[model samples]
Target: MKKYPFVYLACTAAVVGASLGATPASAGHMTHVVHAGQSIQKAVDAAESGDTVLITPGTYRESVTVTTPGLTLRGVGRGVVIEPAAAKAAGTCAAGGNGICVVGTKERKVEDVTLASLTVTGFTRSGVYATATDGLTVRHVTAVKNGVWGIAQEGSVRGVFRGNTARDNGDAGLFLANTISAEQGATDTGGTLVERNRLEGNRIGVTVRRLRNLTVTGNHLTGNCAGVFVVGDENKPRAGQVTVAENRIVRNNKSCPKTARLDALQGSGIVLTGTEDTLITQNVIRDNAGTSPLSGGIVLFKSFVGTASERNRISDNELSGNSPADLVDQETGKANTFEANTCQVSRPAGLC
Candidate 1:
């Protein structure tokens, strides 16, 4: 009986050793090479868990969706292109197709994927949409000439948008909206970090609504309709706090003459309405020319909440050729503080 037990142990050890030797150390890191005549969706379909689909440099004229977790879709260099069929559609284009969408139920990540180093254009809706996903990172990417916003994120949490360039989009460069119903109120959709991005020539540079604990810093916003528009709903009990600091917001002077009543209503470098607990500090708000009256450097109007525009410690912030001074339209029910601001332009009373 003792001899039989020893033989069995030896046989089990040999079988385990053979299995380990046959497999590579990083067998989990499988690689799927995507080439010509292969659809990008097929490569994603063939990917197992924790696999990386390495796409070689080519023009791929198809829209892709990522539903798998821990799967990385990377381009060889910067020539990986996915052009849609039509210019604009909500989810997909009737003329062009849709762009890449990450619609994972669990948290997923998509990184190091370049969009338009070789001219991938013609999409409706957005170039990239990260909906109901978490930990999605879009870095070192360029999205240009899209139908709507360049990058749109809805119901996404803990996402990072860094080193991305968005230009000539139909709407805002980056549109982030948290439209959870009141019954599903305040679902902590992760804190969004937007930094070091070049957002220009869009309808709006960045539009944020119904979010919490957002930090937008070190970005360049120029030649858009509005630099940064922060809006919220008054009926909601939860107040979203935003920190806008150390950004260069200049020359968002697009005209809307037909909406002269609207233009004369609200316009500025940083436009805020119905938002609370916002910190607009250390930002260079300069040369935001308005098409009509009621425009200035940093304008806050009709905000029935509390904000602190102090210690923006604004200095050397050149406000030239703008009709009004640095701060304008100090209304009721909104508490704000303006301190240490240097403005060179001339304005009327109560606009300092």
Candidate 2:
């Protein structure tokens, strides 16, 4: 397997603040610098809106919670690490077993918070978890060996997850859902972007559940049980209107047993269930071979909850050496089109 270095997009502090709708550093914004052996939470607590908490290179054994809007938490170098706390804390985030939490309320979203250039590992639940936030950017971070998710968000909009590495997580490496607590209609993410990330050795690379208006592009995913899963169920405004394009997905043959809600999964490049108007195009999927029911290069599977997928387009993708045929459409839905694909063999014939 080829490894890709983390791509760093350099920006001035002023430029980053402006993009997040925060006060510029030149305009009396404070930067609270914390050295090794110092408490990052102390600096974060002292920081006001638009202030920045800059962490130096060291391992921090504490869970960090950021509720202040427009606050920036950044590490100076790649050696910054955050692991599980030594003792249990009273904070909601630490109690919930997450490394970092950016939280807000339903009526008031924490806006424009940034987390960059750090490694969060060995958390019981998630590495970075966020909810009720807007314009949140997470970049160049590494999350590994988390029990549940690597980087997860729910009930948020306008999120940008770029240039990150998530590996060996128990669940999806990057998970975005409308809400995990209830069954509801899909929510619009207002063009959230998941791009240029490396995800491997997880149950799934990326899982977008009950979300719309997002794009998963330019990602490299391999050695997971499944690569990308766009999931929906029987609900109003069913999940759709998302794009999966220009990704490299290969050799995801790790087997995972059947869960309560899903069957066994392996060798799935991109799987769509109970979605409509989704576009799966221009991806390179190769050498994924398995015998699971969901195994294929690009599969349109029957929804577990009996919701049909309709009007989705699968086109112009490059696929080779995938088992159970390259393209498998088990559902007989309306107006789904497959055209102009480069592949050898497809289930039910003529799709390739």
Candidate 3:
């Protein structure tokens, strides 16, 4: 708990605008600055499109839900934290009990939401959760000690998550699940970029579920149960095209409890559970645990008989000193090409 210079105002004239008048969307950009002892939710609720909410450095113990588009929540510093309230003490936030939850319904189409320069923690599910938005940007944020993911996005499109630090959580530091649904439809159909983030000491560093055109690059993932796990299920087989390049994915051998999800899937750097057309290139995949048959620097495996991790290209990766082996491909994987990699490979895997 670092002390920041805060404006100790009981009630300042900085209340959000009273009545909304018709203003040009291009010209009317307002900013509502809230101090400590004030309600940030009030500022967000009263804010119109293209308005900005600036919160001063302070600790706020409440769950925030913002639904408007083009609304930005900018904190003065990372010292501005939002912890869980007593009401949010439930086991999970998937049913709407999150620290900072931003949602846009399918019929509403809220776009251009941003959450930047803030620290959110101590929630039941995720520290920050966003879903079904047209374009969402979460930048320079910190999420720690949360129940599930540090940042979790589902059914969101055009998301840019960068320069974030997520650690010591119940699940992955960052989790993105962009799948088709009856309510959300096809989201993130274009693509999503996850770059230059730090993930450590979690169940999984980063996890993707049925996403299309996902680029995961320039990330440092270490000391997690699994560094990166991309999977598609039996129902949705086409999990999308993924490119994992230029990442320092190493030493993801964090031990989990016997009751953990994928408990045997530990000590692996990257696991392609069931995705199609994946290109893993130019990555430093080294020093992973490789405890299980599936654990290694990289693994291409399938969950079921019919479903397979297909059409993958694993090339030009530096690997060494793994417990089990450098690379592994289960019998269910099909048509995966492994070539031109610099590493000590397992049996049946020869360098090109």
Candidate 4:
């Protein structure tokens, strides 16, 4: 694991700034307008690279997929919605269908795709799911009330999911799973940023797994099972260099649920399980109470066999009034280090 010595905010902010500075392709590219009753899938299928599929205001009932590169699917205004195709209450796509699925693979990698200013809901699976796409951007969108995650990405690289609202999903609001099947080769996802978003009313707010060089900052998280989770122990071999900073994570009051996902940790601002090379700092973590004594502000726990959540740091945060304690640790997690954190109660209290 490469030690990310630079500040997370600076690095990601620079990248976001560079993206903002680049010229958008819509200026000279072809624009296809899809009316409310028209087929967005047809428009996307007909679109070429650097083309824009502009959706007008109204609710469309269908699942949209993007396979072309350098394409932008943007709503004209706030009222554009992609709801579950009412014909089949389960959705029109195959079982476990998402609202929008942007997919690619090593053989044919999609690049420079953007989805913006739209609302997607009522999918049986995630609202928006992207896999194996590079240079992906999801901004100013709303994903809500999906069967599972609001937005989910897997095996992706160099992505930005910012300025969005993700809430009321069955599972996590935003999920990043980076490990591909070993048969595909040992490629760990990298260079992703999740920032300036509102995540609430889900099982987990931001659920991260096995993504390297990720930065989560300037987000508001509340009313969820847990605010942020940096996971390891699935034994994929790489989950590192994650930074959670300058966010407000408070009052995530739900307990762990008994379901197919089998969530065992909840009611915490941040939970670190079998991770490494992470930094949590400059955030306000408080008022998260749950039924479990293990629920609290920051937890460093382990469940898997490798890496052991070591070389992680927590510093300069305001933590208080979480149920049980402000900081909790279990199962050989003393390898993590903390510095100058403002907390009154911590399990193994000497760390405070």
Candidate 5:
């Protein structure tokens, strides 16, 4: 990964200046109203650090980039739409290409924004890309028909994504990648809380890679190719300590060819690969039946060589109405517990 050198320089300068007893006071708050013939970027450029850009109800054909810290861009109503300026710049003829891009450092918090009643669509990549931000709250946002993920966050810490609706995206509805380089022996990413989000009709509802200390709770994931996929490998050894609890995973079946039988099909309630030391509790995994026979309610595949999934708990889950299988496979690693689960299909008459 290419290190953001200018960002590092800016952060270092800010830290040193802060250490020299020159503590920078919080920038005063301001608000800008976006109007016709005025671009969103121009408004952002004119506003100070801790300002709010109130976008009026209109269709704005622009791609906005938010580099300012502690800023909240709010739309008045659902009519506020931001799309790519032109097709050539984003390499796609879609209506909206990469809706809002946020790049911030560690010092500031991106908070208190109600991104509601707006429709973000037709992005070439992701609808929103938030990088290196903290305390960022994305609530009640609607992302639809994007080429890639609806929402993507990389290296973000302490962010809350709640009540957001993501649908018909090419890849996952919400993609959270925590692959930041360790600085000063501390990981800059992780500690994110994703809850109460509605993700449907995407390739995957949620895909988390190379993350730790993530809490995905109370999210409704349905009608996707895969409900939730947790992937880790030798390269990402520390992708553990994640808590996947209280989420409703259901009906994530995708149609596939008949030749791929006995292979876990596109729809899986929860697919865990090389994931260990995690808590999978109180989730409702059901109705994940697709055309392929490899489909299962919950699957645990060993992706890493010589690595086994151990000490993981799968309890109190209502696993029923799944295709191909209802529970664990033989290849899955051992020492995992399956207790108090209401499985429609099981080995013995009672719970195993």
Candidate 6:
């Protein structure tokens, strides 16, 4: 929530910038190869901007931090693993208890850093944590058994997270936030995309908190305590302008104990709190049943901070077997619409 005074870009330019990551290996970009016994940090520290550090298939007992722009840290195959060292690892990445960290300051954002085809597990905190980055891409990585998020980003813009597997994390499988350190207005992401990922066995599959201008689409989420959560609070530039579409969220009935900030969670498909102008459409949500206040197929609950959910649209979703109701609107928010959704039950009746 610390103030992220991003220079707002034109709409067209923002859309273009959203797709600016994923730079292919060019003719001249250097590639540093690391063998089984070598250190990845040495290779990464030796790399310049726009360089590639290609790691071979091996278990690397270390944490990696990337600060250079346009750098690619890619593993050759799925056998490449990164975990904590025997002793305490060094640097801020290990201090943060993350397997990998892509860090940048607010004054200078890291641009176009990519992480692909690796497995980072058994960390005390997040498997992969990124902050203050632009055009970051994380694809085909497996993050499991972490203490917190599987993959997380904050104060970032134009990120692409696709084709990843995140399971059995202590918290959300995928988490994106405006800022976790302070209270401020939502930050525009310039259309970040979260697509086609497999998320299961976490507290929540995906959590988008106090962020705007992003799309969560075509993901498969199940076996978690909850599916997708779009969270907001009473702040300026309200968290909205998001599209949640074409995802399969089902049977997330794994019970999770209540945290300091939230109630105990179970069987929640998609929940939106204190958000405005968001679209929840075309999702297949089924068999999510529990007695929690937030449990439902698609729910609109009053925010704990007392902000009303306003001007949101829920349409064209297929829902069934959800206990209490498939569609629950527990708030008296204005301008909220529920139309064309195939569901049997609703809280105040007649919203099917």
Candidate lDDT (C-alpha), each: 0.62, 0.90, 0.77, 0.79, 0.68, 0.90
Question: For residues 1-352, could you state the per-residue lDDT of candidate 6 as single tens digits?
Answer: 5522212111211111233222234455666666676788888887778777777778999999999999888886578999888898789998889999999999999999999989999999999999999999999999999999999999999999999999999999999999989998889999999999999999999999999999999999999999999999999989988999999998999999998889999999999998999999999999998989999999999887989999999999999998778999998899999999999999979999
Candidate 2 scores a C-alpha RMSD against the true structure in Å of: 7.1
TM-score to native of every candidate shown? 0.76, 0.93, 0.86, 0.86, 0.79, 0.92
Better of 3 and 5 by lDDT: 3
Better of 2 and 4 by lDDT: 2
For 1-352, candidate 2 gives per-residue lDDT tens digits of 6422222222236232322222234655676766677788878887788777777778999999999999889986468999987877768899999999999899999999999989999999999999999999999999999999999999999999999999999999999999999999999999999999999999999999999999999999999999999999889889999999999999999999999999998899999999999999999999888899999999998788988899999999999999988998888889989999999989979999
Better of 2 and 6 by TM-score: 2
> What ordering of candidates by lDDT runs from best to worst?
2, 6, 4, 3, 5, 1
- Model 1: per-residue Cα lDDT over 203-253, one tens digit each: 778878667677888999888777887666454544357777788888877
Per-residue lDDT tens digits of candidate 4, residues 79-102? Answer: 899997867533334245789988
Q: Which ranges of candidate 1 are over 4 A from the true structure?
A: 1-25, 86-97, 105-120, 180-188, 256-267, 292-294, 303-321, 345-352
RMSD of 6: 8.5
Per-residue lDDT of model 5, residues 3-111, tens digit only: 2111101111121222222122344554565654567776776656566666666777767777776666666545677666653553222333578877666665454
Q: Which model, 3 or 4, shows the larger TM-score? A: 4
The runs of at least 3 residues in candidate 2 whose Cα sits more than 4 Å from the true structure, single-residue gaps closed, are: 1-25
Give residue 44's error in model 6 in angstroms: 0.8
Off by over 4 Å in 5: 1-27, 90-97, 105-117, 180-190, 256-265, 291-294, 304-307, 330-334, 347-352
| Candidates 1 and 4, the one with greater lDDT | 4
**Could you give me the TM-score of model 4 versus the true structure?**
0.86
The sequence of per-residue lDDT tens digits that candidate 3 reaches over residues 223-329 is 88889888675554377488889999988888775443354657888888767888999999888975675688888777433468888899999888766778877
lDDT value for model 3: 0.77
Minimal lDDT window, size 10, model 4: 6-15
Query: Which is the better candidate, 1 or 3, if ranked by lDDT?
Result: 3
Global CA lDDT of candidate 1, please? Answer: 0.62
